[model samples]
Target: MPTDLSPVDDALADALDDERTRQRETLSLVASENYASEAVLAAQGSVLTNKYAEGSPGERYYGGCEHADAVERLAQERARELFGADHANVQPHSGTQANLAAYQALLDSGDTVLSLELRHGGHLSHGQPYTMVDEHFDVVHYGVDPETGRLDYDAVAARATETEPDLIVSGYSAYPRAVDWERMQTIAEDVGAYHVADIAHLTGLVAAGVHPSPVGVADLVTGSTHKTIRAGRGGMILCGEERADAVDTAVMPGCQGGPLMHNVAGKAAGFAEALTPAFDVYARQTVENAAALADRLQTRGFDLVSGGTDVHFALVDLRETHPELTGAAAEAALESVGLVANKQTVPGDHRSATVASGLRIGTPAITTRGFDAAATERLADALVDVLDAPDDEAVRDDARETVAELCRQFPVYDGGAVASA
Candidate 1:
């Protein structure tokens, strides 16, 4: 029972309450989602949202931007400290926007851009045919090694040599292993292209020093603050001092206007939290829990991409073991039992993206709820049971019970009222 909302707009308030209940009672395994802290949430819901600051800190298009300036500066300083970057722009509305601004800053229209194939784990903004980026740029794609389900630097190098793209994009949404940022930088350098690493999915891991940082390696780095960092829903760009002005102008006048000041406050708060020692433990536990879950899933006869994971998530390739099960069906069955996850495309997926051949399971949200390796192992068992007998009501009933018990044991958000059965 939180305050402020129940007194007004009961309809929307009830919906919010229901969502909170759902979050508390279910295991959130989405790779691109995480729960923001109360401090971060408060900051996001603050009155700062009413303000409009159209420019950078200290230099604004409107008056009464002193507080906005302070918040943005704090966010930028904290982000720079966390990622060891000479510059950080905390204004992009989302990770896609951040990447868009980066491209706009570094490359000209019709410039050749090389990025990973979306079906093979890249993001849509990297040059999906339907995106505005594709309409504006000449995009080429590289892919993972089908046999290994991992990137082959030599193959990427060969492609770069042939295409000679103006920009090379790295980082991914469904990749379970760590990226070799230095190798990507070398490839871009050899081809005389700028390297833009989008660590949207691993921002918090990198901030906690659990995953390797691309701050100094890549020519430009962009990420979403909400995914792993648990900040407000927004994006950030980090680069060297040399590229700061270009990125600033691109983000401001080029892609968007009026920075989200409330989100910037949230980013400041979340970054402050990450600077503490407790966040280190949380980040380390997130990886360890994912590994534990993967090990358990593997033992249950599931094939994982790249064999296993080195981060907060694992991509379960079901093409071999459960050829009949599409990722959509698996996702639906799991969701029915309150195990929230997403369908994903494998390296050599034959099915469409909507009904992928793989499932991406993440441990960030569950780990944030104080779930350790043992709890994750139990979750893996429940997930396997549901997937093993997705059409069986008996199996779903049993799995639902297991999930309920797990939720009760590791509740979220001050143990908010559980959703009714």
Candidate 2:
């Protein structure tokens, strides 16, 4: 190995190298995560992070604004083209940050906001009692139908009429089926509420033409570039030209300080890559893999929320299959096999966040590594086997071997300009 590390930084460099090797050897199945291409990674590591342009392009609060202006402009333009929105602000640091900005822009303190309940299928930023959303705004919780484990739009409408919230928040972290955004917007409008859609998990599908888009339907749309978009870790707000200044100002002065230009640059690179024909293929395959995994899990007697998935991730209800094992145990067992996944809370779950009753699986990372339906089936088999035999070392070892074979068959690394570097 070529050694250029100084003595003081050598230990840190070695640890980073170990992590890189681990990523190359194992699978990363985290739903909110994806592997970036070499080009995107390189852009994120560029000199851009040194600049501190506190405001939008062409009107910065600092010197040497030309390049930062270009970077931010590229990100904004790509967002507009990808989502067909009138304006885009690529400033918020993450999905939650974007939601905070949207809330700041549209609602006042104590204003009621209707959102999916966190334990049922919503993000904490939507309004868990311990979060800032809950502290500053009154939250009206909606949830999936008790029988179907799907969003009860009728109930949501009824709740909206009763709460008369200032904003109706749509989109979800664990919903398997699509939300009726058109109807949702109508309900919000009738209740005199602003409709905001957080499309963080489904953005890439919308970009790839595989999933329905809420871009033109919702008054304000926010999403993370990292999830389905497969960009660097950051958030963006897309809205109409009428709401541009409000959204921008809220994100800038009201919420965060100077933007992380490196993240912004990576967002632009990822957005550019998302617009390509090959990325469209990848996005399509992502859904295909997810659907296959859900189906196979159901076939193996594990319950899937909402029947199955039409997106990149799904929730597996473990009550029937592993009735005695907690979600945390199942998650750990799967991890021991090198099949990465997270414990999640299912609707009607008796368990809380610490030991929930569901598992969240996504196909983005495996799909990005070129795995498809067959690979998803194999992954599902490994998860089911591990969960079934949580105490069996032999079962764990076999699953690990299977995972290794899958990784070997579908190797992934940063593939653009940075590959050479």
State each model's CA lDDT, in order: 0.92, 0.87
lDDT of 2 at 243: 94
Model 1 worst lDDT window (10 residues): 412-421
Most TM-score-accurate candidate: 1
Candidate 2's C-alpha runs over 4 A off are 1-8, 414-421
lDDT (Cα, tens digit) per residue for candidate 2, span 22-86: 77777877787778887777788889979998998988999998999999999999989988989
Question: On a 0 to 100 scale, what is the lDDT of residue 363 in model 1?
Answer: 93
Cα deviation in Å at residue 1, candidate 1? 3.3
In the range 79-139, model 1's lDDT, one tens digit per residue, is 9999999999999999999999999999999999999998889999999898989999999
Q: Which candidate is the best by lDDT?
A: 1
Residue pairs with backbone atoms closer than 3 Å in model 2 (clashes): none
